[model samples]
Target: MALQNEKNNRYLLRDWKPENPTFWENKGKHIARRNLWISVSCLLLAFCVWMLFSAVTVNLNKIGFNFTTDQLFL
Candidate 1:
């Protein structure tokens, strides 16, 4: 039935209509903001991991690892 379909699709966003102020105010805005926060958090985590690796690489030579300049740049 139509009512059952509506219930099932409630969380799917298949019927998204952000142009409709009512829909945006009620649902679309929340979903968009949540996705934005999740994306930002993922990017921040990736940058932190990259910084950790860079710090470790810079210390390798000082720790007597003897990596060549080219090898360390890799």
Candidate 2:
């Protein structure tokens, strides 16, 4: 048996049987959905950060930075 860290409410699950329809209907679906949303949220956050940098770089000239190509690349 796996020992759970009760103080943190973290479980070391000994087994996972999400393939069982009863389990899937009751718990697996919720777990799966939560994981999917978490992944999507992370992807969106990453994309936003990437776009922010791209936008900043594109507007450097318009903002009158007077930076060289090598400087901007830095």
Candidate 3:
């Protein structure tokens, strides 16, 4: 059965075939490596932001917020 394509004009099926040798060697490898680095950088940045929150909350006592050490642990 023939299926109608999506509205974006791209194929909808998963009939993928990476048969072209040069296309695989050049374009596909570059795109894959760049995407991997982008993912790693995003993960590191998220961890850094999380550490910032930890530092600020630890010093909450210095700001005279009336939160005891036990309360902060909660």
Residue-by-residue lDDT tens digits, candidate 2, 21-53 = 998898778777888999999999999999999
What is the Cα-based lDDT of residue 39 in candidate 2? 100
**Candidate 3 — which residues are off by over 4 angstroms?**
1-24
> Which candidate gets the maximum lDDT versus the true structure?
1
Q: How does each model score on TM-score? A: 0.76, 0.66, 0.58
Q: Single out the weakest 10-residue window by summed lDDT for candidate 2.
A: 1-10
Candidate 2 segments exceeding 4 Å error: 1-14
Rank all candidate structures by their TM-score, best first, as comma-separated numbers: 1, 2, 3
Model 3 agreement with the true structure over 18-53: per-residue lDDT tens digits: 477777586656666777999999999999999998
lDDT of 2: 0.79
Candidate 2's displacement at residue 11, Å, is 6.8
What's the best-to-worst order under lDDT?
1, 2, 3
Candidate 3, pairs of clashing residues = none
Question: Which ten contiguous residues of candidate 1 have the minimum total lDDT?
Answer: 7-16
